[model samples]
Target: MWYVIQTQTGGEEELVGLIGKIISKEYYEECFCMNRECVRKTEKGQEIFLRPLFPAYIFVVTDHPKRLFLQLKRVPRLTRLLSDQEDSFFSVSEEEQIFLENVQNEEHIVQRSLVEVDDEGMIVKAYGPVGRYRNAIVRQRLRKRYVCIEQDFWGKKRKIYLGIRLREDGKG
Candidate 1:
């Protein structure tokens, strides 16, 4: 099962490292922050970058949540585990976990999607993770080269923006 840990925004990487050192390997299978690939226009040319998909939150795969929680106390800058009450950690729902597992790659990065749009600025075809969840798209920001998708994350509705490279159909 995957458990969520909240920490300071922009401190996810450092917190993950801290947790790894404090927690025993037997208690957790993996600890990582999900990332998304984005294309940025730099002075040199187009550049790709990775950003946290869920800022301030990292995911840990563990069967023993109680033990992991206890060990996490020693980790500094960690906010708290996603829980309903004291000492009771909540794992992501099966549906949410499946969606996350499907969209992210082995490195836990959601790669930028390639999309083809018609003259009317409508997405005609999409490839990659975007293609897999086309119906979930709530807004298309073609000018910004991304789309906002509404997804149920951690039992709440979240609008996630994913990078997309758009090419006009019938043109090279």
Candidate 2:
């Protein structure tokens, strides 16, 4: 099962590293934070960069949640494991996990998708993770090069923006 850990917004990477060192490998299968690819305009040209998909949250795959929780205390960072009102750790739903797994590659990065648009700027086709959820898109920002989709993540609604490379249909 996948569990979430909330920590300081800018300290996710450092905390993940600390948790890895403090916790035994037997307790958890994997620990990581998801990232999304973005295009940034630079003095030379457009550059691609990776940004955190879910800031302040880290996901862990573990069967032994109790052991992992206890071991996590040894890490110096301020962290909290997400849990229900009853205090039981909340695990990612199967549907949510599937969506995440599909969008992210082996490195856990959501790569920029390629989308084809018509002359009127209507999306004709999309290729990549964005394509899978094209119908669910809530907003499209072509100039900024991203499309936003809202999803229920662990009971909370979150709007996620995925980067895109647009091409005119039949032009490229």
Candidate 3:
């Protein structure tokens, strides 16, 4: 199932990186980390490091949120799950999971990125412009649904959008 955890502000990259290491191979059947790479030039750079498009948030997959929560509690930087109560936790929808799967299966170019599939089997990718722009973004020409990333334009910072493009596929 899917779950949301509170990440320390500006600590999304560290959290997601930790999620990859903590969730093990035996648990591979039970959990996974949803990581997408965004390539941007650094100040002195002529290279690229795969950075998370979603900075302060990450999606992880596990069979039991309770078990996962306890393990995560010990992690130095993690705060809590995104819920009304401090301890209460939640899972993501199955539909969201499927969408993420499709994106991860797509391609990846340097400037472009792909929403990767983490073990939990959820679409945890920062959906909107950035997501859709990833070379790996999925496209179902027949359905006319663009499962890409794009900015929704709601947050104070610039919103990133990712999804498929129906119009571009000549479906419209």
CA deviation > 4 Å runs, candidate 2:
168-172
Candidate 1 per-residue lDDT, tens place, 35-142, comes to: 998877789967889889999999999999988888787776656888999967889889989989988999999988889888898988998888889999999988
Better of 1 and 3 by TM-score: 1
All candidates' TM-scores? 0.94, 0.94, 0.48
* Model 2 poorest 10 in a row by lDDT: 163-172
Instruction: Put down candidate 3 lDDT per residue, 1-172, tens digits, no spaces.
Output: 6666667556765676676676553332333234443323358732334444445655656666666666766667745655556556665556545545544533221133233334553334533443544443343222322243332221232433233322322322
Residue-level lDDT tens digits of model 2 in 1-172: 9999999997888888998888889999999989999987789967889888999999999998878888888989898889875459989999999999989999899998899878877777998989998987999887788899888898988999999887731223
Candidates sorted on lDDT, descending: 2, 1, 3
Best model per lDDT: 2
Residue pairs in candidate 1 whose N, alpha carbon or C atoms collide under 3 angstroms: none
